[model samples]
Target: MITAVSELVKYYSSFVDAELLKAYLAGSRSEERDPMEHIEAGVQWICQAQDAFECGGVARSYSMIYQPYFRKSGWFAPYPETTGYIIPTLIDYARLVNSQELVDRALRMADWECRVQMPSGAVQGGMIDQASSPAIFNTGQVIFGWIRAFHETGEPAYLASAIKAGKFLVSQQDEDGAWRKSLSDFTMNSRMSSYTYNTRTAWGLMELARVTGDEEFEEAAIRNVEFALGQQLENGWFRSNCLNDPSQPLLHTIAYCIRGIMEIGALMKNQEYIARARRAADSVLARLRQDGSLAGRFNERWEPAVSWRCLTGEAQMAGIWGRLYQITGQPDYLKGLRRTNAALRKVQFLRTDQPGLYGGISGSEPIHGMYGRFEILNWAVKFFLDAQMLELSLMKKSDIRLQSNGLGDVASAN
Candidate 1:
């Protein structure tokens, strides 16, 4: 009881920044702004994050609070895992805006990734300065950046790097397709051994297969995904899926799981994989609040595990829901997409004096929430841009009109 009180006191006492405190007190209320404006701000913030470190990779996050224990605050070191995925987002945005600068920035990031690749062809976990151990999930993520970079530049080096990373993943897998080794040290716990969320890693392998026409990579990806599907319950909840707690998985990891299955299903033309993904997506959709907020974590029975909102997860679900609508032509998925995106826009800081917070999405809705407490994460902004871009694309294609309130209604579109 004494320890709990002490911890709570420490948490509150850490709010030394008056400006950040004011922003926290304001909560995640929606503000009226243009989506493109938000996108541009987010892109600019990301560029700033990349420049924070001497390396060309994106910073892990920007800390809003000062911590004496870590003896450091502000933009963190370059993170290879997120920087790998951010490449595709930057490239997509660059094309949309016809900006060669963003394209060159993404290529520089890709080149840095290749230089840091471990001798075993795997990427390290955590920031560049952290322990240089090879991680399964991180390696899988870097493959995405390399693959996209290869397509963009037609550079043999990018494909070569991707192929090496894919081989390392295949070599580390057990006979049952689950990876019991090379887990990220940051997420390691004595109780958890296998992570079902590695399905995202499987998606990367499948992409390599498509590009290289290697049946070995495709077969390995299939085996791993099938293993993950076996862990799904009748209610669509996955066991052994969370980064730290499998009993109450974060919505961020949940979205990762669903997206991997959904994309792989579409690529392979498998109805079963698509159906499984739909079941999980529908379960999460049923839990969305009227204001478009979802609990940061959920239990196996589809119950909310926390009051705070995981904004990154919500942005990811927006994209997933949008894709589902595209696949099934379902109205509910479209409604979900609009509601979630609307909620995110409301919370995004447009006029903050802090460059780190401007147009950047917090890990949680409230600045001090548990997910990425007091920090603005780069991945959050990346997902937000992707979801908003998707929503705009679909609206344009279907001739949907945006309402005065910033959210468009499907009834009006028809």
Candidate 2:
């Protein structure tokens, strides 16, 4: 009740200030509006975001949201966590179109992350300035980029960095496979001390295990995944998961858990694990509004906890659905994937005069909502690009305009 009251107080207080009120009104209009007509424009926005950060050389993240009040001369600062994982997207896009531009960009990002890595093989949480402390989660994400870089260019440095990070993860693991120390702010709240979404770290470890043929890494990854699996309720709810709040978990964290479980399941060929992931995913799919937007937060019962949608979560879920459909041959999953992707596409502001808003996905439909209020998040654009790319791989186009039957047959044909 206290949390609820505090949130309500925060919400109502937004109207008291003129700047906040103006921002909220503009966001409200953006939310109710239709999606842009072209997926190309959103793709352009994603490229712009990448370029926006590339000016700094390592192609890190933008430190500030490009807004009137928040505008600054130089905004590029490499966010180690997102930049680490963003390598795969850049590499994938580069390979798809044979674009050396993207390949060079990916190489620069990988090199930057490797250069900034802590001696202990960990990356810091938050932005470079704020995340001065070593964090296991951030390190795991960086390992992801490093591993991909190794595959793309066979760079010894990338592999070496990934090995260091993977070893660090193994060294930090508890007997029960849970990471008890070096946590990010996402899981350091007083209300919770651990998060199930660290399954993402486990997922990264699994990748390392595959490449290095290290049984220890595989065992550690599986141990952590087992820990996450134990948190799954019968109704498919995952406990102690969220970026900030545990009581009301964000769909973004939930998708992270689901995707991690699904990937590891595929790797280990564990049908039960795959089934469990699908069950949790189905619960989320059940809550999708007819318009394809999902509330950012959900309760244990899979009920909406917030009216605003988390654009990042929506994109992540689309990728999850796309992967599920590819694996399980589920028609509903493909349908939901397309619908959700379309809804996200609709929300992309192709005609925006504001460069910050041009191709960037809003953190929430109304920019003033709780998550990334009045800002365009780098990860939002990253996941949005991911989903679009996944959709393109499933079907032959960026737009989800293919027939349901044709799309459903993708896995079978492959």
Candidate 3:
């Protein structure tokens, strides 16, 4: 079967002849949004982030790219984790939207990261007037993007870039088995405050280690994880945010923690991480209903507060369920996954008006559409092409692996 990346390549090259292109060229409504427009929209935000180098390393977060931007009641520029997580989405979008131009632009951003890395083994999420800074959360997501760029192209340049980010993360670990300002700084330092930050970053670390077999990467992942575990609440659930900040216990942030920890758990063979993930999954599942939906954010008391579009939460929860099923071979997880996917399908992210091969729907409904299932667009493409890729793994048997990541297929010359 053909891989998702191949489909993406076809998507990218078709843009010139795409109806959207004609519309844009003709100044008509017949023009759909360019996939690169989407990618560029994303990348443009990256340029505004803590590390805006203009290299096109748009490790975009919806926060970065949202035009006519208005801040959330409690949100700010560049969601920390998405900055890293958007790497693959942008790269794939770049590839499918014209691989050479977009991917090279993405590579330029990745290149900037390699050059400006801090000695503290810390990386910046976005640029602060072109200054050096770092955060475990931002570093993780950025590393993830850089690594995915490498994976898509197999270019030494991308790989080298990823290694640089990975090495910085590895060096940032603290002695108390956490990667924070200090071991005692768990109060507001925990990533639990930010949905998907910990998980994406952790997942990124594992990705780098898995591909490169770098012991340091692995060790840093382990240590950073142990630190996160230390921050877990008594009943399960990661704690993040300032003690003064009344808003806490976000479902989106928790999902990131869950995915990163669970993926790392399986990869590291850490039963504890696995068990913890299961418990969190169970916690989430318990809260989930027969209708396949979840509340947005919660408090320490498990009280639902102001709920909004939690697209990332739903999508990652599906991914987490898929991972759980893969690791334990549990049908329950699959059922849970069906629920998540069902809910996800109802969301409006599938702007199926395929104006271009690689163009994606602008998600607005059940999903706010950034960094969550957006990443899964590739997974879905691959899954659609190869149904077997969706099968769960059995702990007693082999791991579930999708052969094609939907990022690098070539199109036939027209």
Clashing pairs in 1: 30-346
TM-score of each: 0.92, 0.84, 0.61
The best candidate by TM-score is: 1
- Tens digit of lDDT per residue, candidate 2, span 1-414? 986675666555534654334444454123423232233444455466656654322323332233332233224455788878877766666665678987787788888887888898878777665647778778887788898889878989999999998988898889998887878654456476667888888899998999999999999989988999899899999998876777789988999888888888877888988999998999999888898889999999888999889998999998888878777777788888878988887666544555555666777877657887656666787787778767666776333322344432222110
Q: Rank the candidates by TM-score, best first.
A: 1, 2, 3
> Each candidate: how many clashes?
1, 3, 22
Error of 3 at 3 (Å): 54
Ranking by lDDT: 1, 2, 3
Winner on TM-score (1 vs 3): 1
Q: What digit string (tens of lDDT, one per residue) describes model 3 on residues 90-131?
A: 454454446576566556656666555555545654432333
TM-score of 3: 0.61
Q: After TM-score superposition, what is the CA distance of residue 99 in candidate 3 from its true location, in Å? A: 7.3
Encode model 1's per-residue lDDT on 41-86: one tens digit a residue. Answer: 8898899899888779999998877544344578888999999999
